[model samples]
Target: MITAIVLIQTVADRLTEAAQEVADIDGVAEVYSCAGDVDLIAILRVTNHEDIADIVPGRINKVAGVLDTDTHIAFRSYSSQDTEATFSLGLE
Candidate 1:
């Protein structure tokens, strides 16, 4: 799967509504309210890279309150559970 980390900038007054709308979009796996330069972070998982292109521009950008978006494509993923297992060594 292709994973995209989308950093969103939304109109300050419409942040919640914008986030809710983005979360409803297909292929968007998760949405988070964050503290930083970006207002929201959306995790998108799709079968093809082209899907990211379509989602970011065709849909997300068109959301009413969305001001801007920055997308990052992930080549690899690591989860804390995976790391914990690696350190366990199958020990009891």
Candidate 2:
């Protein structure tokens, strides 16, 4: 599995809508509106590396309010619990 955090910059007054659209995209696990340099944060998971290429520019970056995005792909995922539990519940 591949996981990534997509830092999204959106047009003014579009965070809520952009977050919703991001969550609706395939391979996106979660989307949150944030108060920071980036307007939104999104969690994405895919079966392969190629999926990121296909999903990001083709789907996410194409969303109406999305201005730009920076993606941080996770190289390692460490957890005490099962993988599913860790990912699903976001535990340490």
Candidate 3:
């Protein structure tokens, strides 16, 4: 799977609505409203790179009140869950 992290900026008054709309889009896996340079963070998981173009500009950007989006394709993923699972293998 290809994962993309989208940093979204929305109209001040429509932040929540915009996030819901983006989350409803097909490829979006999760959406988080956060404090930082961007208003919302959307995680997208898809089968290929082309899907990023289709989901981001084609769907996400078109949601009402979405002002702008900055998307980054993930080259690798590292997490404590993965590490824990790796270390626990064969322990059962």
Candidate 4:
């Protein structure tokens, strides 16, 4: 699976609606309203790399109130859940 973290810039007054629309887009796994340079973050996952474009600019960017976006494709996932599971392997 190809995973991308899309930082979204939404119109100030339309954040809530923008996020909801983003969440409804296909290939979008999750959307977060956050505090930072960007207003929202969207987690996009798909089977093909090219699909990222289809999902991002093709769909996501067209949503109402979405002003701009920056996409970062994940090379690896090192979540705490995965780390904890790894450390617990031989402790049983």
lDDT of 2 by residue, 3-75 (tens): 9999999998777888888899999999988787999988899999899998889999999999999999999
- State every prediction's TM-score relative to the real structure: 0.87, 0.82, 0.91, 0.88
Better of 2 and 3 by TM-score: 3
TM-score for candidate 4, please give it: 0.88
Q: After superposition, how far is residue 10 of candidate 2 from its true place, in Å?
A: 0.3
Model 1's alpha-carbon lDDT is 0.95
Which regions of candidate 2 fall more than 4 Å away from where they truly are?
A: 79-92
Residue lDDT tens for model 3, 1-92: 99999999999999999999999999999999999899999999999899999999999999989989999999988989878887885755
Clashing pairs in 1: none
In model 3, which regions exceed 4 Å deviation?
87-92
Best by TM-score: 3
lDDT for model 2, please: 0.89
Q: Give the TM-score (vs. native) of candidate 3.
A: 0.91
The 0-to-1 C-alpha lDDT of every candidate, in the order given, reads 0.95, 0.89, 0.94, 0.94
Q: For model 4, name the residue pairs that clash.
A: none
Clashes of each: 0, 0, 0, 0
**For every candidate, C-alpha RMSD to the true structure in Å:** 2.6, 4.8, 1.5, 2.2
